[model samples]
Target: MTVSSTSPSAQSSATRTQTSAAVSVSSETALPTSETKQAILTQPLFVYNPEYIAFLNKSLATRSPEEILEWALISLPGLVQTTAFGLTGLVILDMINKIRNRRQLAEHPVPLIFIDTLYHFQETLDVAKRASEKYDAPLQVYHPQGHDNVASFESHHGQELWKTDADVYDYVVKVEPGRRAAIENNAQVLITGRRRSQGASRAAIPILEIDSGVTPAVLKLNVLADWDYARVWKYVQENGVPYNVLHDRNYKSIGDWHSTQPTAESEGERDGRWKGEAKTECGLHKDYFKMRANYLAAAKKRKLTESTDFVLVDSEEPSSKKIDS
Candidate 1:
């Protein structure tokens, strides 16, 4: 669901309507009807309500990331930012700090949500730790189910889950945990570091969008949607933000250590991710509900089959159980 184009003042009023019975907006004038106020409140989107998407796309078209974030903090209640602490994520983290510092706000408006897949490189975990301390942003870290480290995670899910099934890999490690974090924290809106220039499925990301990607879709905003890698890198460098040390070694977009690889400039920004596969997104930006259902089904099948399969005492010595049984 989306709103139609309206003046900034009128849109600002629409934001107030979401919270109160009064149809109060920016200017003194009121909108025509009580029904108009109801429509604004009833929309599926949490953040995109007051301003039409077109209005946001055009008005915020030239605004800096800081400007966009400022509007977001004011407009959306229960806002949270999720990241993997990649270069773009670091850039936004710095912007959040700068915006809050300028407003003289005692507390950060949006808390950070960092999902620990338990398969992340040690460097990625280090970056998350350093970013939380550096920005002093209220940080919320969510790990996969009950696992905190690789050895435990591997024991729960078979070794190299990604190589076995990328869908299950994503559902367990990213999609489920991300959704859980949002709900657990009461996150009404999720701001991300996605940029249109990231290429592939991410090439068409919008400035503000309803993430129909997940069931019970959440409102998402790509504050840096207009930026490219160069812009993000420049911001990170100038601000001296904490970033994963692996980026210096050519890991462009870090996920698990197994999936990521170094990329030449010619290979494009996200080519190093899920390398050699046609896949671009790691199911986080896709339909996660569909993937979860499939993963569970496959796991059930595996469990039933494993119970019947006889283990070999040695490579040359099979169990005495009948092969047919």
Candidate 2:
């Protein structure tokens, strides 16, 4: 979807009647049960003790990304990769392809999960399709609940929702969809593309850590955590990995079209994302409980407003009818 030029406040204040219903339905029906949550928490496929995880991080620190991937493939259960088709993710995808070829495997061992925010650049979309096809990896794509594309999303939530309420927008477009993908895939470990060089919240990220944001904590393997932007670019060039074309235009890190921009040569890789904002990582990598709470609160307020308006209209209709009669 193309980015709209209208300012968020200036955008039409369309009532979100359909969006409220959708949110209510999803909150009621899509959330996992207590038993299911317990199962996901207690019945982990691998040991996730803090001490053991620390040991794994130290052990994998000096190893190559490929080596890390190989170890994870054999050891980590329910492993999957989440990507936005950035340079780092593409490098990992290429490495996975090489690993699969060497092992003579028919299918890539680890599948991929992509959250389509419906506001991504056209270049990002093209690369996702191309990379998945090239690697023969299983890609499961998820979107915001009730809406399939940008037009429907804007029609219900109003145009430029991110400008109006960023937290609510992030929850709907990225956080919720990512959580759903994880649950549906039964993912216990996620291969991520985060790196220390990205700065901000990622400056001191370890090679692996337990992600407690979502229900039933899952392991996140930053296979490229120790790698720098130069190294990542070198690997991408040597391996000819498919990546977003925006990189050619100075867009170092890519997200939704509205929030992403091109970084200067001296800037950090992710400087292009959410430029001028204090934000770094998207809500997908943040606390799921907090984001959900905020989104639910917003939805409740909207519902109440809609209900109030309905009552007022209903009460006035009879008087107007009597006057007419």
Best by lDDT: 2
Each prediction's TM-score against the native?
0.78, 0.79
lDDT of 1 by residue, 148-235 (tens): 6778777767798888888877887788777766655556667888889988777888787766746233567898998889888888
lDDT of 1 at 31: 23
lDDT value for candidate 1?
0.69
lDDT of each: 0.69, 0.72
For model 1, the superposed segments whose C-alpha errors exceed 4 Å read 1-51, 213-217, 304-325
Candidate 2 clash pair list: none
In the order shown, the candidates' Cα RMSDs to the true structure are 12.0, 17.0
lDDT string, candidate 2, 60-153, tens digits = 7767788777766655556778788899989988988887787777667666777889998888888888888888876777777656677888
